[model samples]
Target: MSNIIIGTAGHIDHGKTALIKALNGFEGDSTNEEKQRGITIDLSFSNLTKGQQNIAFIDVPGHEKLVKNMIAGAFGFDYVMIVVSAAEGIKPQTVEHLEIINLLGLKEIIVVITKKDLVTLEQLEEKKEQLLMFLDTFDFEIKFIHEVSIYEKESIEKLKNSLFSINNSIKQEENFFRYYVDRVFSPKGIGTVVTGTILGKKIELNEKIFICDSQMESKIKNIQVHNINALEANISNRAALNLQGVNINQIKRGDLITKKGHIRGFDGIDISFKCLKDKKLHHNQTYTLFIGAKKVEVKVLLFDCITTLETGYATLKADEKLYCIFGEKIILRNANDTICGGKVLNPIIDPMKKNQKRRLLEALDNSDFTAAYKELLDAHKKGLGIISSTQRFALSHERAIEFANELENVFVDVKELVIYPMETKDFIKDFIKIIYTKNTYALLSNASINLRLKWASTAFIQSALDELVNEDFLTRDVSLYKNSNIKEDFTKELETVFLHRLKQEDITPTAPYNIYDDLDIDRKLGDDILKSLTAKKQVIRLQHNLFIHFESLNKIVKEMKNIIKEDGFIDISNFKTRFDLSRKYLITYLDYLDNYSNIKKVENRRVFV
Candidate 1:
């Protein structure tokens, strides 16, 4: 193995020191207090070579006072060396360490028992059996066992050969360049420098490195692996670097360095908290949040008009503002309840809620463009719309113009970033539903952005609409579009009612049945007719209670002539009495006629214009 991290686990004075010396042929305890007090205080380091494979060893403290130090030491290793002394059987630190390992999500393990020579062969076997029982419960198993005292000058090769069988054969990953800084110092000749385990990928000399979390940048002057000048370091290998352009004071542990603006730090996010099965919480509770190398203080509050936090349900609120992006992992805690927490649903978000809907719309419009492109296929399934490439850039978060080139070729599409699939079938159904109900055709421009759907953004709605039009599921009339496959039929009875009412007085009916004696339908259908007429512009919609067929006033006037032909004027009361209609209705009809100057209103009475 080119680079594989292996760490040791056991309580204080469990022969961790002697075991490392026996396996690696060296002493790792470096601090003066450790050598004087005869116990590991902080973290210690060593190297184990098994045949052609080499593995680095991290030995952490096991005393109760130094548990936090142990956590910091083992936080990033991929494998563990679980040391159980044959004489002692099992210890509290061993179980606590196991819990920590589980919480960190680690699965790889190598179990070892030390000081086996002190016990009888039978006793050693019994102790091994007991450790195995505990191991079985924890899902960890030992691959090798050696019975030798710290004074043993033999069995080193046997232990080394066993390690060879288990060490990973594959070389380190060289794709994602990430290094967790564990040591920082200045050499006699070199100014500011840092060292870390180059996890996942190697780096090129003189490459521009940026501290994303800190927003700092520098040029790499040199690289060293295992104290040798190296062109590059592979993932899982220890590396030291000389950085040339930044002040040492600004560089600190927990500061992640990468390409500038490549990793985004978000302030607030939408998260789901797993309420403990029985614990109830009130809003605005404070907590300490631990994620990766950073620990932040969080303020938890219930979401959207609710105050009490009940079990089994999740709510939204900012416990703290943490900068992050999609797929980033987060944990929330009530500082009082150390291990109780939740994960963020949306890792990147704005902290403010004032005008949240508007902010959401703007963010979603941009988010659609920057999100992975696979989501486009989903959006295509539903439909598509138009968004400026600028919006796509905004959605890219900290990646900048990198995704802009990828998004330029497509026109109105159900689009997503490179990863998420967009769903469009429901959108098309809704599109058809609206058109079917309104009895109207929509241009692509209007259909692309129906105000009814409330799709986070106009751009997103249009994206879906345009996709539907292009796929031929719907037809576009230049700037407009509508569903082409749809055909709605009215019953003959309904058609006759509509046509006769329109033909009755040679004008469109304000509404069919209300003006026609022969026309009739169910109450629902009557409502449909009125709505359809308004959409068709067959009748104009005015103030709340008024509607008029174009010829109703005309027909009324012809009838009025015989009774009032010689009159100088007409009274509103007299007109309503003669028309046999409510005064409000008659007055509204008269007002409509007056607007056309068919009659003049002179102080509550009307005369011919």
Candidate 2:
């Protein structure tokens, strides 16, 4: 039956306790001091049940010293009972308490006129008129108000019925759980503890949550509401919580401990606010700004008091250190107290401002995804980059779609807060593509001085040369990339291969394609091909691919002949294997090797001379 908490508010000794006793048939003020004085010093409570709903009455002290106590009582109440004495009518405490309610953002309230028996018809009418005048200036949206006298029997029943109806009329808007800290105490056996009304839902034990922006996490150890050990507290109910792993020294009454990364702390995003009409607001004038459990004095930069505040509208800033990120509603008070205020743009970030574009843009440049795309495009214009969308948006997928749109020129698709630009894929296969065209099919020796470039990539030049065979750029016989028939002025190509291969294994050459993989190529065909000089004896061919066409194989043959004649036996296999040439090509030039009269081929791979 415990579902709603109804609080009584009015001047001191406004028959608040008497009224509660009449409603629930119980004395809510149980303390000796309060009983002796007939005034509620601390918060008093009683429960009235009808059918299945339980309504607890909170009789708060109307004294000025007890305003903080009033706040504690009101923290968990579902609906407020604004009790005004019919005899005394409206008072200072009534207005002050109303201000407190508005500050806390209470929405449901019912006005109760008590002690109607003490006033006459004309007197009651006059008091009601005065109460209406006061109530008209307040901000809350009240559903209904009624008159009742505690001295009459069933008067409490009448108020209880009204409260029950009002409670039924109320609805809780579903949102993430938020508990406003009202009291912090040390419980027996348990260390530091805090209490507040359960804002919404059931909290599980051992759940870790953040204390606003401190980034510190606290663990929920235990909970209690109204001296009851509630296994799980629901919304609109008061509760105490024992938290562990966080020092009470670090936590204060206003600290909001919540799930990490749930709420953003506010900062210097300029806001539009409605100031009190009579308050003088000058640009750059500093004032106190209170935003949800936090407050500071900020300067007013963009505001005009003459611009018609309508009692609750203005845009201003904070000159002091404070944090209330976004989607948090805030109030603007001058050096003097007031509650004129505004709401944030969204829950994720401070609303962007025009005046501080440079600073905001700087953060955006470092963070905003779309702006990053623009930077990416600029880099493309400079032929500079292909940066990731994650790097562009700083990896905060909160604004991922809008962040991806920033890279729209390239194309963007977002999934799971990840940005994958289309440009990233566009270049994957077509990267560095170049079209090679000719007037007609080119011969291996006829294309551009008989030199075909397979590729320009340093990592895959040899593969690209192999690719050239696929592309019909060169013959399949082109083992070395330099197997081109390209004619060049210098013998550098073959000579470089010779020097490298000779330095590698130094096997005597018998052919041209004597490539050992360990021997690195220093060959560049266009500039390094070895062309025979027809005017001089600069070429020789000892055997097959080992040809210097200018000496026409004679001088190399003579060298081979001298070796065989002088040594009595020749090792042509050693020379033939080194240049990868066949023995037939060696024999065709063997007479050129001079044979010294006899030539015999050995089956065990020997050369006979």
lDDT of 2: 0.54
Q: In candidate 2, what are the lDDT values of residues 321-372, reduced to their tens digit?
A: 3434333455565543553555442222223343343343333424443453
| Model 2 stretches with alpha carbons more than 4 Å out | 1-9, 12-51, 54-78, 96-107, 133-141, 168-175, 267-271, 280-327, 334-336, 346-415, 418-609
Question: Model 1: per-residue lDDT, tens digit, 1-609?
Answer: 456777778877788777888776667677788889888887666676645566777788888666555665565566877888878978978876775665454567777777877788899899888877877876554555565566655655666666667656233342246565655677687888877666545688988887665577788899987677988866666677888876777776645555554445555555444444455556666655554444566566555434666532232334433444332234444533324344434444433344543333334434543443434333333333223221222233224334533554433323342221234434545754465345432222443244344433455555556666676766654454445664444343454456455546442234443442123223344455656766766545444534444355466656555445656666676675676766665656556556645677778767776
Error of 2 at 80 (Å): 3.2
Q: What's the TM-score of every candidate structure?
A: 0.55, 0.53
- Cα deviation of 133, candidate 1, in Å: 1.2
- Supply the TM-score for candidate 1: 0.55
lDDT of 1: 0.57
